[model samples]
Target: MSTVKKTVEVDVPVHTAYNQWTQFESFPKFMDGVEEVTQLDDRHNHWTTKIGGVQREFDTEIVDQLPDERITWRTVSGDTKQRGSVRFERVDDTHTRVELVMDVETSGPVEKVGDLIGSIDRRVKGDMERFKKYIEEHGTESGAWRGRIKPGDTSGPAL
Candidate 1:
C-alpha cells in the first residue's frame, strides 16, 4: 500500500468546506481524473475515474462521519482498493484547513510505478488545490447533509 497526504487552506468557513465535501456528486467538478460520483445513499457512493487512459469503477461506504469535523470512507467493492479521510479545521470564521489522507493498494505494475514515482501524491495535492479554488469561487456549498454516522454503523437514514 502507498500512503498519500495533502492539505489545502480554503477561504471558506469550516462548515462550508465540510458541507460541500458531503455532496460527493460534486467531486468531479474539481477532483481531477474523477469522471463521476454517484451518491447511492447517505453513506455509500459509486465512483468512476480515468487516469492514463485506464478507467475504474468502485463503490465506497462511509465508515465514520462527524459534521463539520471529518468524513472517513473505505472501498466496499472494486478493483481499486483504498481508504481515506478528509478533515475540516477552522482557521477562523472565514477560513478552513482541509486535510486528506489516503492509503491505496496497487494491484498492478503500472499503478505501483505511479505510486513509487510520487504521482499519486502529486495528483492528490492538485485535487486539494482545485478544491480550494472551487470553494473560494463558489462561496457556498451546493448542498449539504449533516447527518452523523458512527464507525461500523450502516443503519443510518439515507440522504
Candidate 2:
C-alpha cells in the first residue's frame, strides 16, 4: 500500500472548507486525477478518474462524517482499491487547515515505478494547493450537504 498525506491552509472558515469538500461533484475542479464525481446519495458517490494514462471508475461509500470536521470514504466497488478521508480544522475566524490522507495500492510495473518516485505524493500536494486556490478565490462553496454520519451509520440525510 502507498500512503500520501497532505495539508493546505485556505482563507475560509472551517465550515466553508468543509462544505466545499462535501461537494464531491466539484472535486474534479481541483483534484488532479479526478475526471468526474457523481453523488448518488448522501453517503454514496461514483467516481471517474484517470491516473498515469489509465482510466477507472468506482463507487465509494461514506463511512463516517462530521460536519465541519471530517469525511471518510472507502471504495465499495471499483477498478481501484483505495480509501481516504478529508479533515477540516479551524485556524481562526477566517482560516481553515484541510488535511488529506489516502491509502492506495497499485499493481503493475509502471505504477510501481511511479509510486517509488513519490508521484502520488506530488499529486496529493498539487491537489491540495489547487483546492486552496479554488476555495479562497470563490470564498464560498458551490453547494453543501451538512448531513451527519455517525461512526456506525452508513446513511446520511438525503442530498
The C-alpha lDDT values of all candidates are 0.92, 0.90
Candidate 1 minimal-lDDT segment of 10 residues: 150-159
- lDDT for position 139 in model 2: 96
Q: Per-candidate RMSD vs. true structure? A: 1.3, 1.6
lDDT of 1: 0.92
Cα error, candidate 2, residue 13 (Å) = 0.6
Compute each candidate's TM-score over C-alphas.
Answer: 0.96, 0.94
lDDT string for model 2 (1-159, tens) is 988999999999999999999899999999998999999988889999988998889999988888999999889997678899999999999999999999988767777898999998999999999999999999999988898887676444433
Q: Which stretches of candidate 1 lie over 4 Å from their true place?
A: 157-159
Compared with the true structure, model 1 gives a TM-score of 0.96
